[model samples]
Target: MADNLLELDTPVIAILRAPTAARFAEVTAVLQESGITAVEFTLTSEGALDALRDCADFAYPIGVGTVRTAEDANRAVDAGAAYLITPVVSDEVIHEGYRLSIPVISGAFTPTEIHRAWVAGSTMIKVFPASLGGPDYLRALRAPLPDIPLVPTGGVTHDAAKAYLDAGATALGIGSPLIGDACTGGDLNALRDRALALREELK
Candidate 1:
């Protein structure tokens, strides 16, 4: 199993949230088959911690998202999470990640928040709800803060992925647009099709 995020070649982070994480393995297998390896399991899901411990042997980076507190961060790390992702800028979470030596993708919306997160030692700044500003906003942010790696999450569609990358997004945090009910007893085939389509779009 791979433990390092640096080994991830694809710049796409699949954000998975569901009623239960029992179907996580099945869904992750489909994504892996489609060439999207990086996956984030949000704590809001049922049995997510157990799933993280269960998927420790997976051969790709598996991260924990929606992390808000230091206790959750520690718990995730103890459960073998390769990285931690937050929905907002939390100094405690970022410091915990730094202490644990795990990467933290801190979420932020405005330029001030982004810079603050970067300076606070966030591994990457997740420009959340990126649909609001779109690629042009990313371009504007990159103009001054070119060195900060940005991952745009929330409402990133397959067709718009390339535009985000073109706008200087280091990676994308995609959810429903890619997962598409796969974890909720929806068609696995449909999920695969979407994943394949996303791969093609990225290429």
Candidate 2:
């Protein structure tokens, strides 16, 4: 499972927060077509689990985010999520996710929290609100903790993705900028075009 997580060749991880299952599927299709092979559906999104199940056949990996409890982790696993991501670190959630042999990306904002998540068995340390400090922050954190795999999420734009990768980020989780309100508005073609442009920029 860890290998699978690491095998996500594309650096961009789309964060989808649609309000309906149909919109989620449509957005996911657009992203997948654009070469983005990993996506996250936050639990706050309505019918997120069902959408995950609905897209189970897609070659791309599907994940759950904002998971704060072991129960939520289990729900994601049962729904066939390829991985689990949290907005914050939680030992119980990490341990439980590991027991199920699913990769976990636990969110953290500080050096201590990032290291703690790594020690707790997180597959990757997600630097939440990464735009606040940008690449310089990740570069500084990695100086002492070079071995920890870090993925920067939140407020990441196409240009920011390159900066994060240059700053030693193992991967990126892109929201709004990649999978935006165009999904809710039923403009899948626009979303697809945006995803394609993002993929090209990452390339």
Candidate 3:
């Protein structure tokens, strides 16, 4: 089920791609306070590894994103990532992640790629830029490849998460809409409130 893929009780996954370490921490605190149990720091973000280490003590599941190589996967593991998420499927990264006993979510856009990632030992197949296809895309993909666990990422909104779940996605990966831009001036209270609202909505 969906619960098996996350290894956590909650279905939400917060993507923290802030431009600075301070902003990353700020966003992470807000997400935790909001009751989200899963968080990911994209490698494209500055100080992402340090930020991951900073929040290692939180009760939620912490993970890293945009991982492309074995070295990146190892770095993320060393930084205390409970899981690894890649923007694209990489055998090297997936193999390294498995070696470290860290669950890997490999990004795949097509049924072929999804099946490939699943066969490669990926914990879940992330459908990147999922907005383009929306829930309908997942619904269509599920008909023939119902066995693959899919997590729709990129452009997923708080209001749209449940639809993806209903459409057969294992879970949802929320980014900018949830975390907002680091320079846009984030409001911890607002983020927390939104997160809480999202959790409630999911239920």
Candidate 4:
């Protein structure tokens, strides 16, 4: 795989933010069983990069999230992260993704912020805290910037996943909603079930 996240027909990035690296494998397995191909292991976890490397052999895109600096971006690229995801728009990090030819999903909410992230070379613009505005917010943003690949991440749930997509989201960046407390309780089956439901809903 060339590790391009944008190539997927159903672009759903399963944001896995577990407390322990031990659970990463199980969660990843469940997601894969449910046909989830794009995943992001947040940097907050102690062994996120290690988890990413371990899953590098999987036939899907695994990326690093919550990236705030160019150094972290560079490190993630070196660690074999297929893409980079950020909660905020950072010029340095976005530029680094461009230089590395790794897709970057930089987060922003407002028109100005979204546009800035796009111009900074982010492969996709993530609308962080999107729940605050809901799918309607994305609809408004799309009015003017119809070409930007807006990814509405954070606070997105399966019940509302289709609406966001209908509102113009290129993809959905889902976290706890899909993984749930499975990471904490080690419920791989629960995560798998949710992933299946989500996949069906998106259809």
Number of the candidate with higher lDDT, 1 or 2: 1
Q: What is the TM-score of each candidate against the true structure?
A: 0.95, 0.95, 0.93, 0.95
Clashes of each: 0, 0, 0, 0
Q: Report the lDDT tens digits of candidate 4 across residue range 1-203.
A: 23356555566888888766657767887798788878888989878888878887776667899999999999898888888999998999988988988889998999999999998888899999999999999999999999999889989988899999999998899999888887677577778788888888788
Please, what is the whole-model Cα lDDT of each candidate in the order they appear? 0.89, 0.86, 0.83, 0.86
Write one digit per residue (lDDT tens) for candidate 1, span 83-170: 8999999999999999988999999999999999999999888999999999999999999999998999998998889999999998
Off by over 4 Å in 1: 1-7
Off by over 4 Å in 4: 1-4
lDDT of 3 by residue, 97-201 (tens): 889988899999988899999999999999998999999999999999888878899999987888999998878898877776642476777777778888888
Candidate with top lDDT is 1
- Candidate 1, after superposition: displacement of residue 190 in Å? 1.6
Where does candidate 4 clash, by residue pair?
none
Measured by C-alpha RMSD in angstroms, how accurate is candidate 4?
1.6
Candidate 2 matches the true fold with a TM-score of 0.95
Candidate 1 has a TM-score of 0.95
